[model samples]
Each structure stands twice: as structure tokens, then as C-alpha cells.
Target: MPELLSPRIDAISFRQLRLFESVGRLCSVRRGSEECNLSQPAVTQSLAKLEQMIGVELFERRPSGSYLTPLGRILYSRVVRMLKQMVTALFELEVPGGQVGAEAIVHRLTRSQVRSLVAIIEHGTFAAAAAALQITEGSLQRAARDLECNLRKNILFRSADGVIVTPAGIACGRRMSLALQEIDWAINEIDVARDIGESRIVIGALPFGGSVLLASMLDEFLATQSKVDVRIATESTSEMMQLLRDGKVDLVIGLTQETVGDDLVSQTLAETPYEVVARRGHPLTGQSHVNHEDLIKYDWVVGMPNSNRRNCFDRLFIDGPKPRTPIATSALLFIRHLLAGSNRLTLMTSYELQHETMLVRVPIDVPLPCPTIGITTRADWLPTALHRDFINLIKSRVNTRSIMGVTRTAA
Candidate 1:
């Protein structure tokens, strides 16, 4: 954003990182300087700053040339991928300036300008975007203006409906968001390996996604991974799916979708069988075998509408009378408490109620299907070494639980 970023001289800059990538590719500081059209001394100084900032030496300086350090090679892969995404985004910005291709566009734009435009698009208002970035509104506007002036295109203009982004701006902002995603992953990969800066990973979990596995692992992860920032999103499956696609979440842990999109990949960890349940002393608790007719006589609680579990609940009585569903909720804690207090029944999995003492199975003879619990990540996702190990640990734990004789549960 500055000749070098301010507020923190050690902060990463897109320009400096691009230079680092150049040197990594050429394996010669002089060649990197020539390719970037910068003085060799300036290139060396920028690389030094980057190395100091990351607390790791990226290159082995020698008379012949520069060579990558061990960590540098691991980091180089992510940076290369990041630049490729940026190049693709630049190519897509052929609108507004039909004469400017990716080659020309990359030369004309600055990281700050792209940052401002992306902020505007994401927040829908310059004021909000500025606040989000912790910068002045005037500075944000100036950056956006410079972007338009450089490209000779009006990215945004005031209309009766308020500010409107031109098609070029929309395209640029959309693609840049994706490019920024690569940047995020790159940084996450570095921080995790270096263990010096904060590493962040967001996990999206559906309501019944064998999230209990997360509880035990979460405790150990927090106790151990102090520098790693972990965020869990317990939103609906659809919301989580969209988040995963957009790179807002690192991965999703949930019921395996019936059909995964081409851009997504899923792995089955375990299958849990679903069971109809009621309070320990409920009338249906003593039934040797209960049918839909007997079960519908009392009030019940079910999962959120349209959820896989709820859909399965619907099929239980597909042939006849519907039960009086007094409540519909996805929160297991609330469901357990509500069932304990009322005569209401519910459909649940053994894994979900593993430690509960009040609820017991309402034995039924129907052919119940089980849900497969697993992890879903972007097909393009490239996890850091540590990240991959963590996911593997989850899979292994689920399998171990199954081996220990935990019943397979269902959605």
C-alpha cells in the first residue's frame, strides 16, 4: 500500500511477495532484479525485509546465484499457485479496456487499488469498506479513483439508486476476491509451518455432522496449537456449502451430500445409525416394537425442516398419519432438555446421545437407514502439512470410535 506497508514495516506486501516469487523462480537475485526492472540492491533489500518479517531465511545467497531454503521451497509452491490465480483474474478484466490484456493490466494496477475495489464490492458501500479496513474514507476513495483512472474506466458511478459498480468493476472485484483467497491460504501455510505468526482455519459443521468428534479434538487442538486460530461455523448445510465454495471456510464436516458438486470433494469417516427416542419413562419406551401408528399418538420434536434427518423422519410415516411435531430444532442440547421435560419423542443418533442419561431408544422394527459422517473440502484445497495431519487425525479418530463398537448412526 505504501512504498512499503506502514503501521508495520514487517507486514507482508503483495509487491514484495511477488518479487520473492520472481527470485524463487529465477534462482538468481540479479535475474529477479532484471525481470522486475528494479536495481539488484533494492531487490536484495526487499527480500531481506521479507525474510526478517517471516522470521525465516528464504534464500541462500552465493556468488553464483540464490537458492531456496528448505522452508522456502515449501512456501514457494503456495506463492506460485497464488500468482497464477492473480494472473487468471487479471486476464478476466479485459472489459472496460479491451486493448489491455492480462499482461498490460498487471502492470497498471497496485495492490491497494485492488484492495479498495474489492472492499467496496464486498461491503456494498465505500464508508463500510473503509471502516472494515480501519482506514479513512478519503483514502479508500482515492485508491478506488486511482484504479479507475489507471484503467481509463469508471468502475463506480453515482446513480439514482446510489453508487453502482460498472461491469468491469464487478468482474475485477469478484475475481480479486478469489485471488485474495489464494493469498489467505498461502499465508496460512507459511504461518503454520513457521509457527511464528497467527494461523487461521475455519471449519464449517452441519448440525448432525458427527460434530462430537470435534469436541474432543477441539480441546486438544486448543491446548496445543496456541498460535492457530480456529473458528467453527455451525450454520445450515446449504450455507456451509456456499461458504466452502467461496473459501470463507477451510472445510466442512457433515453428512455426506447425496451428490457432491464437481468443485467439491468428500470423504466418508464413519456411518451412524439413527434411532427413535423418548424420555426414559415415556409410554413408548416399553414397546417391544413400535410402528408409525403408535409413535404418532404422542407429541414429537424433529430436526430442522428439509434437513437430511428431518427428511428421514418424514419417510418413517410416508404411508399414513403424520405425528404432532410440537417443535423443530437442530440444537442437540435443547432437544435433549426438551425431551427430558416433556412426553415428546425425537429421532437421534447414538453418537449424539452417547452421554445422555435421560433419553432412551424407542425400539422400532422399521428398516432405518444410517447417515455417513465425513469431511468435505474444496477440490482445489491445498492444506498445510499441519492442517492435513489434523484432518487425518479426525478421520482416524472416527474410525477408532467405530472399531471400539460405537453403533453406526443415521441422519
Candidate 2:
């Protein structure tokens, strides 16, 4: 039987792929030239070479503007995925002693090579990307040629305006990147365990957690562990999620409630009671009894409006649309400062307010609804032994410490 598709894969140069990806992204020859810092003719030559190799026109040109052809569009999507994988690998390499060195020999891709792939994805022109790297476009072209020969596939497609990515190109980049990450992580796991009988675990906490329970618990946990490396970084709740997703840190301890998203796995760690606090002798403090009605009258310094705390506050005061005259909302420290210096009231978890000198809880008898704190990790990444141990440590602390002004047993 005759072969319906080409039995042999077409050859594509990495430079050509870079050039095509650039043209596809930028959408114009002149822009591609300016970005690549190449003479228009040079970019044209690269695109032409790519088209010749692929046996397809990857883009369509019109008077209004240039766009990818159907085939080209498919390729562009693939290229984007591939480039993301390449960038992910480079980010991993920044960590000291990742597995890239040993496994890289088999793939013959250095960190620079991985970065170059990303540059092509970002800038979309070989000349532009090469200029950014301070190397000759011809040098980049040669590198692509070498990569294509090794892969044995026409990884890039091209046309008059720019280049397009092929499915094969995208798949190869993604597979290679994932392989590199797993390898690096595996090596790190071994090194961490070998250095200590138990692996040294790293935890990233949100600013709220950093200032309160997490800080005290971290110190106690480290004291108990003879061999462990624990790192605590303060960031916003959303940023903590990103770090966990990327596996840059083992677990996140914060006020964020867990939700199922792309690759994230959330476990409810605890519920923290919240309350409104104000400076001593403030108007709310003077009231014989504090009530939600009176509490809403003052401009509150609150968590960001969309956060669970703020959202709950909104619901609590739902009868009257949050009297928009003016209210303050910010991260914990700003709220703390406002509460310390002025009569401005702010809502905080009991743990956060425990150490403050100037702030006192209002007399409102209602239980300020609590926000759930949780630990999250990428769903695809199974928790390591060390990761589980760190989680247990958090649970133990919650069991002992007062998160919402009451001990765990009482709550």
C-alpha cells in the first residue's frame, strides 16, 4: 500500500521555527524585522526556507493585516504550548543542582538552548530574538538546524508574513520540558533526603499567615526537627496559589479556601474566626454594646473587597448596599496601621489581632463568620512524605494554638 502521509518527517531548523513563531505572534514583516533587528530580506529568507522544508504555506496575507492560515493557527497553538514548556524548564534550572545537567546530555539542550526557545516564543522573529540574546541571527538559525536534525521533524511552518508552529514541534517541547522537571524534582528529593535522614521541607505562607499562627508554628516545628530546611515567604493569597501550582514550594498555609482548579488539590486545614477591632476609645468602643448596624457606619479597613472576609462583610451588611461614602480595604499591615493610629476599624482573624496593643475587639456578640484556611498543592503531584509531615505539623499547631481566640478543642 502507498503511504497516505509522508513516511519520513520533514526537517525543520530551530532558527526557522523561531522565525516562524515570531512572525506568527507579531503578525507583520516590518514589526518582525524591527523586533529581530534584521533586514527585511533576512527574515524573508528564513520564512522562505521554512516554507520550502514544510511543503505548506503556513500564513495568509491580506490588505488589512496578516493572519495564520488554518494549518498555521494549529501550529501557533502548539508552538505556544511548546514555548511554555521550554520556559518552565529554564525556570527550574535556576534552582541550584537541578537534574538538567545529567539528562541534558541525552537531549543536548543547555539552559541557553531552552531560553532561546522561549525568546522565539516571546519575540516571534529569529532576528529580533537573536538581537535580544546579542547573537547573530545566522547563529540562531544554525542552532535551529541542529535541533531539527536531532528531532527529525519539520517542527516549524512558514509564509510571507511569518512562521507557524507544528504539532510535532509543540509535543516535543512539552514532553521534553515535563521530563526535565520530573527529573530535577526527583534529584532534589534524593538530595534533600540524603542531606537529612528525612527530606527538608519548604513551606510558603501568605502574609496573613506569616504575621500570625504560621510564624510561631514554624519556629516550634523547626525546633523539633533536627534536620530540615523550612522556608516561609509572605505573599498575597493568589500568589501563594501560583507557587504551589508550580511546585516551587511544598505547601501553602493561608486564609484561602480551597477550590478545584486546573491542577490544584485543596485540603481544608482549619476555620479561623474573624472580628472587627478598633483603637481604644474609638466611637465603636464607646458604645454600651457594639452592633453590626453601628459597625457598618464606620469606614472599615478590610481585606480586598473580593476576598472571603470582605465578601462575608458585604453579605453581613447586605441590607444596605455597602454605604459607598468611603471605606478602606487593604492587606493586613495597612489595616493594622490604620487600627493603631486612628479610630478606623478593621476586620481580622483572632490570631492576627492577638499581638496588637492598640486594637481591642468590639463588643458585638454575634460570631463573626470564619474563613477556612487550607493547604493546597498541584493535584497531579502526589504529596511527598516530607510534604505530608509538614501538613501534619500544621494540623498539630492548629490543634494547640488559638486561631480565632479559642483553642481548637473549644472551637
Candidate 3:
């Protein structure tokens, strides 16, 4: 894997990949050369160099013609898809108003420069990011500077604390990160196609979706598709949004907000209502109607500050003084343990408490609005075939009824 991701491996030009793809498609060096407008000798030498660098026999040469080896077939498919994505990215980056300089800037930007910018943003400091990339701070600085010059934007500003990324810089880094992810996804897809290893999908799971929807779908998905890897991250919506923007997360499964940015696309699967819950034998368990005054008498365990759940919790006491949040966290497991051992109250989705024997939903009719739960992905994201299949599976598992009492389409 290290060898595959080495700088030497990445240094293989897009032109080389295009040539190799043409050769594989045509199944003959002479024909590929004719199609790509290159001499047969040049094509042969380029393919030979590519094979040597990858340390694989891509083609079997014979008197009749050239044919792809098993490895060559796998790489050919990946190269085709990757080249197509590259062309699509170029088209997407093109300025609609016919700015020639924008196209030039896109061409000038390299993978390494984009990588350095993303690394700096992720690691929080240039020195730390340089250490992670195993490059000198000066080299990283130069890459950032070159990227800024190419884009004609001030990407970063130096402060006494550290470097601060401008809003424009964050936007640029997000696009670059997404582009790099597309390349990596293609490589991983090729590996999976060859049965070399499992392809991984990283999902940012918010509390509701993790506990309800994905919890039911993951086991079946993994059991049936053994060659695919699934990673679930439970985080606040804001944090998950950042991860999605940076391409660290393939998709987010959670409650959908009323207003999402233009860059993100949301699919509403179902409407999920929040319910008050406590220990089974707790005093509030049998209450026919528990009001905010009754719930405020005891200590509360709530979601993280500024979270959707916390916001809803705060609104419960909007006309009165806010209740004390003795313990504020986002971990559902911890919340369960904390509620079971003590007389504390917390709000969660009904699905979250379905499998828990220790916690029971309080019979309080809280008048909070139900939020729509579903999947969130980048508007420009090009999902692989496997990703599309998994997403469809998730959609199949979700119930269509909206919590707001209306039947809405999943889309």
C-alpha cells in the first residue's frame, strides 16, 4: 500500500494513464498510437515504463497483437473511470463567464499542492502538517504559496497563534480534497475489482441515524458484502458537515436541517420524533404528562451544547429559566449508562430506546417539532457503483412515513 501511494507512483502523468487506457481499449500498441496521435515506438516505450514503475506485467505481447493480463484488465477499468472523472472535474472547474485565467489556474494546480493545503488545514499548523507529509516546512509553504498565486486568492493569513484559513481558502481546500478522494476511490475500486483487498466507506453517523437506520443496515450489508469495509463516526452535525466538505466522510446519515448549503444535497428518508426517556423504574416513567417543571427538578443529561438535540431541549424551557445540564455529551452509550444508574432525564428518538431494556421512554407529550432524518452528501460527489448500491439499501430500510404526519418521497 505504501509503495502504491508513494510520490514516485503518483508522479505517473495523466498522459501516461491515457495512453495505457487507449492501448488496453484498442488491444494493440499500433492502433492505440494511431488513436492517441503518438508514434508506435513512443507508445511502446511509455507502456513499458508504466509497467516497470508499477512492477506488473500489464500486457502480454504476441506477434498478432497485445492483450491485457489479469492485472492489466483491473487497472484499465480504473484508469478509464479515473480519466473520466478528471475530465468531469475540469469541466466543473471551468468558469461559466469564459475566464481563461481560471482554466489556466486549474491546470497549474498539482495534486501535491492541493494535498499540502488540505494537510495544513487538517493538522492546524504548517510544521505539523509538514511532519505528517514527511516534507520540509519550506516545501509545504512553497506549495501553499504557489497554490495561492495560481488561484489569485489569499488562502491563509498568519496570526500570533497560528495560520488562519480564509473562507475562500476553506472552499478551495474542500474542492481539492474532494478531487483527491475521487482519485483514491478509483484506486480502491480497482483493488476491490481485482479482489486484492476490501474497499472502505467512511460514514459520519449522527446520533439518531447511527442508533436507528445504520444500526439495522450495517450488519446485513457487511455480512453480504465481505469485500467492503464500513467505518462509522458519531459526531456533531457541524463536525460531520466539515468532514463531508473535506471528503473525509463519504456521506452523513442523520437528521436533515431545514436549510442546507448549496454545496450539499440531502435526501429525507423519514421523519423522526424526539421522546423523553429515563430509567424503567424511575418516577417519571409512569407519568401520564410530564411538564418541563417536573423534569427540571432532577439533573439532566443532554446532547452537546449547540447541537440540534440541545437546541430542542433548550426550547422546552423557552418561557422559563433554562435547566441545569449537569452532564452534557453526545455519546448515546454513555447517556444510557448515566440514566440507568441515576435518576436523570434525557431526550432521544424512539428508535434509540427500542432495544435498550434499562431505559424507557417517558410518556410526556413534548410539543417540539420532529426533524427529518436521512442522508447528506456533497452535491458534486460522484459515488462509485458500490456506494450507490449501499445508499439504495439504506433507503429501502427506512420507513417512508414522515414524523410530521405526511407521506413524503425519500428524495
Candidate 4:
């Protein structure tokens, strides 16, 4: 059996892991340096140290740029998952009481190294974690080193194959996530103990969460419950749901019908159908007899693959000799911008179209399917009094479909 790359490894700081993530993702030294706000030499040095610590060349560096090796890709995926969990852990709230006991473990780590490790485990990588914390890669590296010394153990396992959490490191990481949550909860509980009613509610929502359908509910809730605190977080579907489940936020508002797993409970709020749209004055805007071939003549911008609207667009355009291949595929904002400028046409949720004034609905003669949008909660956990009220408010205000099949009532 190949010995696990566990013990022989000294500590690698989260900062170095972050540097690796940046180089791996951006695939350019200069670009990664700019994003990480580290000097070129500094980022290079960190990467070198990280590679040496790990004993594998994670990247194939050429004059043109850097590319992830096979091992690098595998490591990147795991790092992303770790970062997501850590971020969620940070927002967790602890039980109200005296501070939890800080166990003195033998690990070689620094304060920066600990922070960097926690940030990376929470946020997914050096670039993303750095971006979220608003710090430099070099600084993060230094901190990670400090944490290792404090802990008296090598918390991060570095190798040419990529960095990972050793058994001890994984145990430590889990504690960090949990303790952070407890700390947050303790702070909130202290506020309550002091007879302070200033409770903050955070809601993680999908891209459409900020739209008119949900926006009105938020406005109404704020007007009535002025004393309650509200913070809205916008992210992709997976990120928002993950955050919700981790207890990083109070609730998640968005499409929550069939996609949620068995461990989640979903509630229907509204039904939204896809509408084929174009710029205000596009040539084919008002044509009643338009076909897929005619639609394919224009440049197209579609949603990212696997997205409901993107899949719908593909299905609608598949009959023609040459399907309307997307020039670019991304989030709704990008699709809207492309549609608002050039002769591009793409699918938009009715809610999205309602928000953008520069777009006009291009009525498709055939059927374009509808997708339901709502909220979800973990089946195992119950929401607090405030979150439940917020959920109810969402249920109440989403009743305005004023439009036809475009907006319908959902569970």
C-alpha cells in the first residue's frame, strides 16, 4: 500500500493553497497575482514552497500560462468543497455562554495559516477566500504559518499532487467550522441576554431572488418588522442551498421545487415560464410567423449548460439544420446584456424580463416550459420564529401573477 502522504509533510499554510488555487484557476501568473494582490515574485515563491512541501508539480507552467495537471484538478475539486463548508461554518451561531475551551494541541501553525486554512476550507480556494476576506495572498500565507506554530501541528498537507487535510487536519477543520458557528451563536445570544431585540436574519437566494417577485415581499417585511435585521445573499443555486443547509444563513429563497434532495423540505411560491426575448427594436421582435431558422440567424446568448432556460432553448432550437449555438453561456445578467445590445435572442424567466426595461418578449408560437421557484429548508432543522415569519411573508406577497401563464401560483 502506498503510504498516505500524512506524517512526513511539515505544514503548508492555507495561503499557499490559495496561491495554488489562483494559479490553477486563472492559468496565468500575472493574472493570478493581480487577483490575489501579491507581488509576482511573492506569489511565485509561495507556489514554489507549496509545491516543494507537497513534492509534486501541480501545474504545467509554460511561457504562455499555467495549466492544472491531472492531480491538480482532483485537488482543486476537493478544495472547492472544503471552502464551501468553511464559509458556511463562519456564519453559524453558538450557544449563549462563556467562551468554549481552547484545547492546546501540538501542531506547527501560525494565526495567518489558521485563518487562511479556515477561509480556504470555507470559501473554496485562495483566490475566492482572499476575495471574500479582502486580504493579500502573501499576508494570508504568513498568517497560515503563524497558525501552524500556535497549533503545534502541520494542519495542511501539501504535495505535488495537491494539498489535503490529514486525518488530524480534517478533525481540526471540523472543529473550526463548528466552533466558529458556536461563536457566532454565542454573540447573538449575548445580545438577547442583554435585553437587546436586535435579531438579524440572513436569507440566501438564487439569482432570481432579488427580482420583483421576491423583492416586494422583502420590502413589505421591512416596513412592518423594522426592528428585525435582514441581510440578503445572492449566489448560484448550489451555493445558496449549500449555505442554507450549513446554517450559514437563516433561509434560502428561490427555485426549490423538484431539485432539492430527500433531506430538504421545499415550499412552492410561484410558477415561472421561459420567454424568448430580444432587444427592444430588433427586426424580429413583432413577427408572428417566425421559425427556428429565422431565430438562428441572429447571434445568441444562452444560460449556462444544465440550467432550465438553457435546456429549454436547446430543445426549442434543435429541429433546424443548424441549431442556435450560444456565442456565450452564463448567468441571467450576461444573457440580458447580450440581448439588450446586439441582434441576439435568448430565453428569460418572466420575472427577469419584468426587471429589464430594454428587453421585449419575442412570442414563440410553440410551447416554452415553465419552472417553479420557491424556498427550501433542511428537513432535520426547524426555522426560528423570525425565519418562519419571513417565510410566511414570502408566501403572502408572491400572489401577484397579474400576468398570464408567465406567472402562476406554485406550492
Candidate 5:
């Protein structure tokens, strides 16, 4: 994407976006004029003005007809999605017994102003935010000031330390962020609609799910939807939750926990039973029975502190003295390597240790509690068609038959 310079966001209207979309779809300005019920000259002028506002040549005018340039295709996709959403919103407002005359509260601020407010809130400093947005400090400050004046509230204040968002400002910024997400989602939706080979999804996964569960499902999804791009991040639950709230990730998959905040929605897919695993040649590998007392003697390798696996491990030994200091990490490959080369034990779901011939599960009669593994997404998120399809594929891959016998535990 390029840095779009102004005529200001207010200059760009829904009408212009709609016209552009029609022209791009039909590949003829005359047909677009007919579709939009405007004269051909008016449609052509509106498109020219839109291009000038965004500082991009949306189409190439040849003898045959007007064909979209690369930038035009991008703009057309976004416009179509935005128009669809606007129509949907209007329909929702017009539902029976609904507030018939209700309309969106018009703000005096421009899109750039709202974007500036959100950027400042996210970056925490005017200079840094301006740099990120490719705008000058003066312009950003003026936009922020204009926003505060329009809202009739002090959105930000300068402190000795730095600029701080006021309580009201925080609330406003959150709404703006969500609105920005809607715009982004509109673009993603259009990409999916065009089948342009550029759709994308970002997923955050915990250690176990990323390594075992998501790995297989993603392979299947990509094989069929090869045009869709997928990026995966493995991080702690808290960190991933923050990313989800910030709209940096589309969804998260992992063991479910009671600590999840109200902003997220979780659906249990399956129950994953855990095992105490050690290197194949470790002293405890072939033992007839392994108890907590016997397991405490060896050094241990565990997930990062406060992680689901680590917390469960701690609870299993709550009555006994704490085991010797263990190597703490979240990297599965590193854990596998450490366990293979040293006298250490680690707890893992059977799925996690499935392909590792160097590691073996210690035979123990004591039943360790199983955790419910599932998918988590933002409560207010509206998925595009592709996103919904991908989610369905994941659900199909979950082994529902095994969930009944496993004991669920709070992580």
C-alpha cells in the first residue's frame, strides 16, 4: 500500500467509492454512469476527482474502454466491500420494530483525524506516531486537536513524562480502532471476493496447538486455498490476547483457560490428555511405574512460567517441596533437544510427542488432568467468507470422539 496524501478524507465520499466500484467492475465509464444513474461526464469527473484525492491513477483510458490500473483494482476492491457493509448497516437499522430513522452519528472529524488519534494512542507519542503514519508532527498534532475540539473533550494531555490519553480519549480511541478494523476487513473481504490470489489471515497459536494441531490443518487449508496467505505466531496466552485485542491477529488456538477476558470468545474443540515425557534412554523411560515422588528426583524442563502446562505441572506437585530449578522455555524444538541430550523430564500432550522417536512417555497409572484445547477469537469479530471456511476446516479436523473420556482441567 502507498501513503495516500490529501484533499483530506472528508473530500472522499461514499458516492465516489460506489461509482469507482461500478466503473471498475463494468470496465466502462458509460456503463458505470448508467448503473449509478449519473451522466457519463459526471461519472468521469467524479472518478478523476477521486483519483486526485487519493493521488493515484485509478484507470488507464484507452480507445477501447477504461481499464483499472493496479491501484484502481486495489481501490475498487475496498470500495465494493465498504459499500456492501454500509448497505448492511442501513438494512439492520431498518429492521421491523427497530429505530427506523436512526442513523450513524456524524462526526465533524475526518478519517485522517480518527486515524491520527488511533495512531497516537497505539504508539504513545506524537513524534513516533507521525513517523509511523508518514506525516509531519505539526499535521498530526493539528489533526488530534481538531478531533478533540469536534468531540468537545480533552482527548489527550501533555504530562512531564509524555503525552497521555485521557479516560474519554481511551474510549474514543478504542472505537476508532474498531472502525479501522472494519475498514481493513472490508479490504480483506474484497480480496476474497475477487479471488485475486492475495487474501491473508494471521493466526496466533500456543506451543502445543501451533506445533501439533494447527500444523496439520493449515497444510490442508493451504493445499486447497492456495491463493490465501497464512501467517502464524507462537506466543504466550497473555501476549496473544493482547495481539487479538489490538487487531494484530485474526484468531488464537490453544488450551482454554478460565483467565480469558470477556473480550474474547472461546470454543472447546477437543480435550488433550498430557503425558510425562523423557528422552528414550533416560532412567525413567522404561520404569514400570512413575509417581510424583520418583519424578521429582530428576531435573525438569518446563514451559514458560504461568503457561498452561507449567501451571498444571505446579499443581501436580503442590503438596511436595518444589522440584529443583528447571530449564524454562516455550520453544518445542529446544525442549526436544534438551530432553534428548540430558536427564530431564517434561510434560506434553501425546500429540506433541507423536513424531519424536528420541522421546518416550513415562508409563504412569496416575491420571494427569487433561486441558480443553480450542479456538479463540475476538467477540465482536465478523469473519470474511474465507475466514469462516478456514475455521470450518479446522473444526472438521478435531477428533470429537476422544473428548468424552478426557477430564477437563482449568489451566
Candidate 6:
């Protein structure tokens, strides 16, 4: 909404947005004036400024009354949603409920304050945030203080350990971001309608299911859709969730258990078991019955420790002599290459090694944990039509022999 999620606090006036919402919903300037408690000229003037600011003629002036343009209809719907969420979050987040009411907060809180709080928390320091926001330290500090006061919560505080965004502050920042994402979503839709922007979906991937899911679905998705960009960002579980909350990553497709948030929803896509994979001609391949003893005889490459696959790897040698100096890494690509060129063995799922035709799954009579892979998204996320199609493709392409019907769980 404001230059790709920087809080467009400067570009948009909350009061103006509320006025826009009122006019669009009532479909008449007179009705909007009544609801907003403004004179007819004031409402009309505000609407003109808003349309000029967003560079879209939001309304077609009708002889009977005002009506939404095609783009106006899109922006208006999202703005209505954004305003509702702001009003609810401001009240429910335990602001002095009756004193500083939700509607008051919506009108009182400036976008600068919202953007400032988010930037401070995300950058983890005042100076860094000020630099990134290109604002004075005094201005940033004042914005944060004003925001904390409005919410009646201790957001940013200096402890002996330096600076910290209190859990409350973190929660507030997330809530603040939700509304901005709503606006950004509207802008994306506007771009699509004008045929001037590339439709992009940023997917968070784990080392697991996305590979198989993408291997099967990506080419087809691109072939069928035009001017679309699909990006996959692989990061630690925590980072991806942060990205999702910040509205950078649209949806995460991978190990879902590590995520914990009140705003996320997850759906199980596949449940896959771990396998001990090695080069086809490796010594373990010759054994019809592979045991921990035989596995320990060879060197091993491993996924990051404490992960389900790594736990299975660790248990393999727990009962007997452990392998000497097993390599530990979270990078599946490195592990895959290491497995083919050397006598290293590792515990990974069949879905991960589907493309590695030269690698053989050792016939190990061992009990291993099966990891559940799925898609996690913000509960209020507005997935575009293309994204919805891609998800449907995944649901249809990855099924039956993989996993049965999908189940959705919310925060």
C-alpha cells in the first residue's frame, strides 16, 4: 500500500481513508457527510484528495449518487476490512477500553507511529530503525512513545541486556502490520486489474515437501499463467514465520510444527517417513538387511540436529557404536551431493530424494518418525486468484499415494 509494505504512513491519512470507506459504502456524498459528521464540501474535498493520492478515480459521479469504479470497488473492500481490523485490535489488545475507544484509536493513531513501531521492533534498535526509516532519532522515539501511550502498553523498554520489544510490543507490531498488508493486497489486485504488474507469490519452503510439490506443479503453473513470478525463500523455521507475519512471504509450505502464532492457519499436505539413503553402489546397498551396526561402519552426512530426520539419524546409531564425526547440516542440497560423491549415509524422506535417482533407499528394518508437511498462512491472508489456483494444483497433484484428504487447523 505504501511502497511495498513500509507502512505508507506518510502517503495515506487514516482520517481520509475512513472518509473514503464511508463514501464508498454509503454510495452518496450526503450520506457520507452525515456518517462522518462533516459538511458536504468537506467530504467531497476529502474524497478528491484521496483519489488523487492513490492515483485512482475511486468513484464515478452518478446523477443519482456516487458509485464505485472497478478499481474503487477493489480498494474499498480491502479498506473496509483494514479499518475493521484496526478498530478491533486497538480495543481488544487491552487499550484503556472505554476511555480511548477503538474508533478513537483508529482516528487518533497516525501511520507514522504505526510504521515507526514496526520498524523499531523489526530492526531491534532505535538508531538502526531511524536510519532505515530515514527519520530523526527524536522523531522515531517520539513515535514509539506516542504509540505505547495510546495502547497503554510498555512496548519498547531498555533492560540491562540493551533494548527489547516487549511481548506486548511484538503483538502490537503484528496487529499494526495486518492492516498494512490488507492495503498492500488491495494494491496488488489493482495492479493485476490494470495489467501493469507481475503477479508474484513468495513461498516459504522447508527442505521437505516443497521440492516434490514444486517439481510436480511449478512448470505447469508457469505454463498456464502469464506474467507470474513464483519465488521460494528457504530459511530457518522462525525466520519464515516472521516473514509471514511481516507480509513478505505469502504462504509457507514445509514442516509446520515449529510455527506458533495467533494469526496463522495451517493445512497438512503430506506425511512422509524417513529413509536411510546412500549411493546405489555403497556398501550398505549390498546388505538386504541393513542395521545400525552396518550403518555405523560408514561415514554419515546429517540434516540439522534436533530435526525429526536428524533424530532418526541419531537413533540409528544410539543402540550401537555411533558413526565417527558425522557431518551435520540443515542444507539438503549439500547433503544430497555429499551422499552421491561419498560413502556418507543420512536419514531423509523419500519426497526429498525423488529426483536423486542414483541414490537408493537402504532396506533398514527400523522405526522412524514421519514428518508432516503442510501450508501455513495468516488467518486473514487474502490469496489472489493465481495463488488459489496454485494451491489447488498442489492439493490435486500431491495426493493419495502421498496423503489423503487435507485438514485445516487455525490459531
lDDT values, one for every candidate: 0.75, 0.59, 0.73, 0.61, 0.71, 0.75
Clashes of each: 8, 9, 1, 40, 0, 0
lDDT string, candidate 2, 192-300, tens digits: 4445234445577766644476776777777766766566666666766766654556677677653448767666666677777778677766666776667767777
lDDT per residue for candidate 6 within 1-411, as digits (tens), equals: 225433433577777888888889889999999998999999999889877766678899988999999999888888888887777667666677653577777777888888887787778888999999898999998888888777766767789866678887677677777776777777677777777756778888866655556666789888877877788888766677878877788898876664367779988877766677887788777776877677778888776655656667666667677887557877767877888898888776756655566677777778677777778898887777777988888777776454422221111
Clashes of 3: 1
Give candidate 2 regions above 4 Å deviation: 1-179, 196-202, 224-229, 258-262, 323-330, 365-367, 404-411
Ordered by TM-score, highest first, the candidates read 6, 1, 3, 5, 2, 4
Give candidate 4's whole-model lDDT. 0.61
Whichever of 1 and 5 has more TM-score, that candidate is 1
Cα lDDT tens digits for candidate 4, 350-402? 76666667887786577787777777776644444456778887777665483
TM per candidate comes to 0.82, 0.57, 0.74, 0.55, 0.73, 0.83
- The TM-score between candidate 4 and the true structure equals 0.55
Backbone clashes in model 5: 0
Off by over 4 Å in 1: 1-11, 37-42, 90-100, 146-161, 164-175, 181-195, 400-411
Report the lDDT of model 5 for residue 166.
76
Best by TM-score: 6
Relative to the unseen true structure, what is the C-alpha lDDT of residue 95 in candidate 2, on a scale of 0 to 100?
A: 22
RMSD (CA, angstroms), candidate 2? 18.0
In what order do the candidates fall by lDDT, top score first? 6, 1, 3, 5, 4, 2
Model 6 earns a TM-score of 0.83
- Residue ranges of candidate 6 with Cα displaced over 4 Å: 1-10, 60-67, 88-92, 98-100, 158-165, 258-262, 296-299, 311-325, 399-411
Q: Name the weakest run of 10 consecutive residues (lDDT summed) in model 4.
A: 98-107
Candidate whose lDDT is highest: 6
Question: lDDT of candidate 5?
Answer: 0.71
> Residue 218, candidate 6: how far off, in angstroms?
3.4
**Better candidate number, 4 or 5, judged by TM-score:** 5
Candidate 4 Cα outliers beyond 4 Å, as residue runs: 1-197, 319-333, 403-411
- Candidate 5 ranges with C-alpha deviation above 4 Å: 1-106, 401-411
Lowest summed lDDT across 10 adjacent residues in model 6 is found at: 402-411
